[model samples]
Target chain A: MHLLEIQNLTKIYEGKKVLDDIDLHLKKGTTLGLIGPTGCGKTTLLRIIDLLDLPSSGKIFFDGIDITASNVKDMDIRRRIGMVFQKPIVFKGTVYDNIRYGLKVRGKNEDSYETEIFKLLDSLGLAGYEERDASTLSGGETQRIALARVLITEPDLLLLDEPTANLDPLSTEKIEKLIAELSKKKHTTIIMATHNLIQGQKLSDQIAILNKKIFQMGTPEEVFLKPAHKFVAEFVGVRNVKKGTATQLEPDLTLIKLRKINIYSISHLEGLVYASIRPEDITLSKMKVISSALNEFKGNVKGIVDNGGLIEIEVDVGEDFTVHMTRKSFLDMELTVGSEVWLQFKASAVNVFECEC
Target chain B: MSEIINAFFQAINLIVSLDPEVIEITLRTMFISLSSTFFAALIAIPLASLIHFNKFRGKRSVMNVIQTLYSLPTVLVGLLVFLLISKSGPLGNLSLLFTPGGMILGQTILVIPTVIGFSIIGLRGVKEEIKELALSLGASNLQTVTTIMGEAKYALLGAIILGFGRAISEVGVALMIGGNIRGYTRVITTTMSLETQKGNVELSIALGIILLSIALIVNLILNQVQER
Candidate 1:
């Protein structure tokens, strides 16, 4: 049975629609990663699910009961869920005081959770921090403290909103590891809103890409590798995207015209379409010596940017194309701006999707 | 200059020796002003909560009027309270006129607006996110407000202290409403005004020093709570 269901949820702030027609469902003990760009109503949806805020119009069913029904008090339902905000919230007191707040609100005495608190704190690497002022802690420490407080409650449903967006890399890893462990439990259903693609793929049983509404939702590979929406394709880091007309002249091949140049892709799409190719999928060489790649372009290097691990080169054939290659390969090829180079990619590398705009 | 210097020493002597009249008047001042502040808070806090928690038609206008009342002249409130409690006035049958009870009532009326105004600001100082955080943690409506009040405790305390400072430092209400009866209704500010008019500088100086000291202590405590 679905543990949570939301139907046609909408939120408007001063008549500006923030979330429109949002529908979602999650099975029990499954982790759903909600990925979206900033200001995409991810936080708003989580807030509504946690019962912190009401949607402008929607029906929510939790545990198969209509929780959003008029005159229904959701305080009892809210207590069964835990939410950690993007920015850590520390009360005015010691670390122990901060961690004990959730239990305190639920009428649990401090003595009841003392042993459990210490064990949880020690596991989260906050040992001996019981007396330290929580407000004085670093961003990472405070975030961990926030997570610890929520985790100690043993909520059946956990809603995390970009829990590590502000932390350093090491702190981010610590938080991610803890979340990974929680996902492993398969007893606490988790819905974590984040823009980090790898974290979403690694920790989620399902991935839902959202921009005000769910654009696509499926297993990790289906959402990341075979996105059904153009926005999802572009957001998942497809750097070279161009609008073109697609024509099918072969049994399983698509030819797209990019103004002065044409490329081939292995997709069955027609009419006005947006085609995207990943920067890493294209290979660059001084001469045309491709083996099996169906699409080949000869263009001048418009610009070169030294990305830390790789070199990002923008090539201008009729349309601009971005290609990323290792620095060693770039150096060995002696590539520079204004240099003529040939790039090749398999026909399958191009992702073509029909769109109205 | 020599008289002023002598009065300064005499003021210190009176405070250190705990002069009977000075002690009596100071104690009465504390009693009346503290009672006034307590009564005002009882009304102002709930009023502030109503103004803050509700979406009313004229909320902004109501807040604007309350803020404007913060600067209401002490003498004006004194006259208003005096009329309401005087023999020919509506509450005249209660016989509260010319009594410390009347002074407390006057001061309470005088400071209600200020207490309400400052309490609103104090409550507003609590970040909107904190309230959401409290509710997110499963706090009920009343519990969420308790959390917000806890977070704004210092600012709320400061507001109350500000109300008390206004009460203890105003003479018009005490003099007009209490009648400054020598043994019954004489409080710090009214007695100071009388003694100063009579050219007894030292007694006035002693009372002024005590009043300033109370203000300083309130401020020191405020600074402590407000420290990061």
Candidate 2:
């Protein structure tokens, strides 16, 4: 049975619809990642699920009971769920007190969780920090403590809003590891909202691309590699999105025509469509090489940006195409502004998705 | 100038010697001011939290009026209280006129607005995220408020201390209501006013030094809490 279900949830703030007609379901002990751009109602959806804010319409069923009524006073319902905000909240006290707050509110004595608290502190790399003031800790340490505070209660559902958005790389890795462990060992269901695509793929069993509503929902591989819609393709870092009309060129190949560029894909999508290719998929070479790849064009490098170890080149071959390559490749080819290059990719590399207006 | 300098040394002597009259006046001043601040806090903190955490019609206008009353003159509050407790007034039958109780009543009225104003600011100053964090952690409604009050305890304490400072430093309310009775209702501010008027600069200076010391202590504590 699904542990939680949200049906037709809509939230209107000041008569402006923020979340419109959204539906979702989560099985027990599974992680659902909510991914979207900023101001895309991801936080609002999490707030409603955690019961911190009520939805303007629709029902949320938790454990087979509808709990979306505004006057629901069951503390037990809230007690079974934990939510961590985007900004870490550290009350005026020592680390021990902040971690013990959840238990304290439930009328549990400090002695009851002393051993467990110490174990969590040690595991979170906060040993000997029980006496340290929470306010004096670094941002990463504070976020860790906030997570510890919520997790110590053994909540059934955990809601995290960008828990590692601003942390150092080490802290982010530690938090991600802890989240995976929680779901595996404690059987805690989690819904994490993040804008980082790689992090969402790494931490979530199911990914929901949300923008005012769920645009697409599937496994990480399905959502990232085979986006079902143009919005998802664009949002998932597919840099080259071309509006074109597709014509069946063969039994297995379809030709997509842009204003001045022609591309071929293995998918037999017809009519008006969008063909998307990730930047790293398009290989740039100084010479046009004979290959089995169906799409190849000689283009001029219009712009070049050194993105740390990688080079991002915008080539104009009847159309603008952004391509990413390693610094070694760019230096070997001596690629720079106005450099002539050949762009080549396989027909399978292009994903044809219809635009959802 | 020399007289003033001499009075400064005399004021130290008075404080060190613990003169009975000075001690009595100081104790009465603390008693009245402490009572007024206590009563004001008893009413103001919860009221401020309620007004701050809830939404209602006219809430902005109500807060504006309260903020305006934060600076209402002590003498004006004293005058308003005096009329209510005077003979032929509606509350005259209580026999609180010309007594410390009357002075406390007037000071409480004067300090309540300030306490509320500061409490609202202190509570509002806490990030909105904290409250949501508390509720998300399974805190009951009362527990959420207790958590907020704990987070803002220093600011709340600062508000009470500020109210005490304002009450103990004002003379108009104490003079008009307490009648400045020598052994009955005389407090520091009223007695200081009387001594200064009588040209007994030494006693007035002693009282002034004690008052300023109290104000300094309160503000020092307030500043310390604010820094944290």
Candidate 3:
């Protein structure tokens, strides 16, 4: 069942449309990842969901109840939907009091949640720091406590906005693990906004790529493998694409022409199109003698950028193209800038999208 | 020159010896100032919090009026309270003129605006993120206000100290409204005025010393609280 649904959500700030007709639905006990660039209204959407900001024109239903209407009380809805902000805000009190603040406000101050609170702290790796002053905790520790504080209220849905954006890599990993563990054990529905694509892919069951609008939404693998829009493809880091036309066709292959180069299409797509290939899909060779590959291009290396384990080589084969190869393969080819080499990728690995005919 | 030195040494001796007359005036001053500051805080802190948290029409005008009141002279407040409590006045039936209650009323009017001004400044200084966090956590409006006040407790304390400092050191209201009646409405400032006019430098200097010491203690306490 859908636990939360937002329809036609719109917010205008001082004549500018910050959020424009956004619609989203979340199933119970599932995590939805919202990935977008800065100022793309990710935070604004989350704030609207939490009822921190009223939408200009929209309807929101939580468990089939309309929450956007003026008659509905915010306190009742907020008790069941918890939100964690990007920056951890611990009040001027002890850690325990900060966590207990929500419970106390709800009239459950002495309801014997000590065990559960401690369990949450332990899971977030914050045990034994309960009595410490909240102001003195480190950034990561404060974030963990903030999360624990919200979770102790046992809200059915959790809205997190860039929860790990300010943390170190080690802290990021810990927070990621904690989020996963909470969702698994408690079956809590979670909606999170983050800029880290890899982390979003790892944690989300469904990914929503939001630009100025809902560019695409689907399972992460589906969206990454076959983005529905140009923006999504570019956002997801599918870099090597060239504008070309379908020049030849067959049951298994289709040929396309770049400036003076002929390239084979991997998919059975026709007409004027943009053909894209993941950099990692292409292999580099010193000479033009490939075995079972359907397409090969002899080109001069334009540039080489070493990125730790993998080196990305930009080659100018009549039209520009990029190929991804490991440091081992690059060393074996002895490739350098201006080196002439053959780039090889099977036709089955290329993705093609139609441009205007 | 001789008068100043004699008054200074005699004032010190009175303070060190804890003279009964000096102690009586000091205690009266403390009581009046503390009561006035307490009353002002009770009225101003919540007013400031309301202005800080809620948006209303005419809020700017209301704030402007408060700021104007903040600078209203103590003598004007004294005159206003004196007229209200004097015989043949609106509150003449209460017969509160020439009493400590009259002095307290005048000082309260004098200090209330200071409390409001400082409280507004303190609560406004609280970060916006803190308010957002509280609101997001489902805190009611009252809870949010209390949380803001708690976060800005030091600044609010400074406001209270400022009010107390102003009320205790003010002479016009205490002398005009309380009438500086000996063993009755005689506070430090009013008694200092009366003793200086009577050429009793020792008592005037004693009262001055007491006032200075109280101001020093209040300021020191405010500094310590802010440091923490």
Candidate 4:
């Protein structure tokens, strides 16, 4: 059975629907990365699942028990689930007291958890800092302390709402590594809402794209490689989107017409259509390659951008198309502005969707 | 100016000499004000916490009413308490009129609104994030209240001190309710009024000095608490 299931959850705030019919399920010991733009109801979803607020409709089940029921003791459910808010909230006391507050309130003997608490502190690079004042700590230190406070309780399910949103790079790395280790070693279920797409892709075992609703839900590969919606395509950084008209070329083949160009894709989408392809899929070559790939166009390398480990080359066949490749590939091809190149990708690489507007 | 200086000197001499009447009045004043402040705090802290943390219909209007009552005239409060404890009044059986108890009661009523008003502001001053953080950590409603109260400790203390300051310095309630009975119900404010009326400016100036000193101390502490 799924450890957590949100069935048709809807949340309306002040007569405005912030979350509309969001349905999701997560197995035990897995991290579900919730990625969305701001005001997309990521925090609201987490708040409802954490039992901080009641849903307008639908039910949330935890371990097959309906936790959203009015009769369920919320304290019992809340004790088993921990949440880290976006802003770090350290109680008014020493770091030691802040970290121990959760365990203390849950009726755990503080003395017995001394070693465990210290171990958590050390793991988070907070050793020897227990006696320091929590309020006096820096932002990164405060967030680390907040996480330690929640983690010490050993909650069954941990909910993080952009836990590392405002941390320094070192702190972000530390928190990400800590989360990874915790999930792997302790098998703690985690649901993290984050705007950092790269961090979401890196940390989450399963990804759910929430934008007033569940736009997409799948593995990182599936969501990034084959987005089912235009919002997901744009959010996932697939930038080569073009509006075109698709017609049946033959059995199991669809042809889309663009201004001054025609591209073949494998889709049943007809009439007005929108097609997107990831920048990485298109290969840029200095010479024409003889291949069975049906979508090949000769264009100039209009712009060459050095993006750290990789290079983004904008090739303009009829319209500007971005192609990503390693810096080594760019150097090997001797690519520069106005350099003639052939952009090639298989027909299956184009993801066509029915245009809604 | 000379007369005023002479009165100031005479007042200081009276205080320095530890006159039994002045000592009794000062102590009684402290007792009455402190008791009123204590009772006010006992009622105000929890009431303000409720208003601060919970949302209910008419909450804003209730808060506005409390705020308006902060400026309630002490004479009006004194009249209200006097009528309640008068011989033909509802609480007449208590026989608290013209005594220290009556003064304390009137002072308590006089300070309660300010106490509650300032306390609500102080408690509300606690960051919303702090309260939410505590609740999200699985804390019970009571535990969260404790945490919030703990966070607003300084401001709440300031509120108490402010109420005590207001109670100790005001004369209308104590005059009307305590009747300023010498050696029994007399306090700093009432004593100052009586001495000044009797043309004894020296004693009046001495009591004024003491009252001003108390106000100064309260304000200093208030500034320090707020700054903290």
> Would you list the clashing residue pairs of candidate 3?
A266-A347
TM-score of B-chain for each predicted structure, in order: 0.95, 0.95, 0.94, 0.96
Docking class of 2: medium
Individual DockQ of the candidates? Answer: 0.58, 0.65, 0.64, 0.62
Instruction: For model 3, state the Cα shift of residue B209 in Å.
Output: 0.8
> Which candidate number maximizes TM-score?
3
Specify the highest-lDDT model's number: 2
Write model 1 residue lDDT over A119-174, tens digit each, in one string. Answer: 88887888999999888899999999989988988888899999889789988888
Order the candidate numbers by TM-score, best to worst. Answer: 3, 4, 1, 2
Off by over 4 Å in 3: A245-272, A284-304, A331-344, A354-357, B1-4
Badly placed stretches (over 4 Å) of model 1 are: A12-17, A52-57, A239-357, B1-4, B86-90, B197-201, B226-228
Model 3 Cα lDDT, one tens digit per residue, B112-222: 888988888988888998887887787876787888899999999998998999999998999899888989999998887778889998888877777788889999998
- lDDT tens string, model 4, A125-243? 98999999888999999989999999998888999999899789999999999999989999999999999899999999999998999999999998988787889889888889888
Q: Across residues A226-255, which tens digit of lDDT does each residue of candidate 2 receive?
A: 888878887987778888999998999999
What TM-score, computed on C-alpha atoms, does each candidate reach?
A: 0.84, 0.83, 0.92, 0.89
Single out the weakest 10-residue window by summed lDDT for candidate 2 chain A.
A69-78
lDDT of 1 at A17: 89
| Clashing residue pairs found in predicted model 4 | none
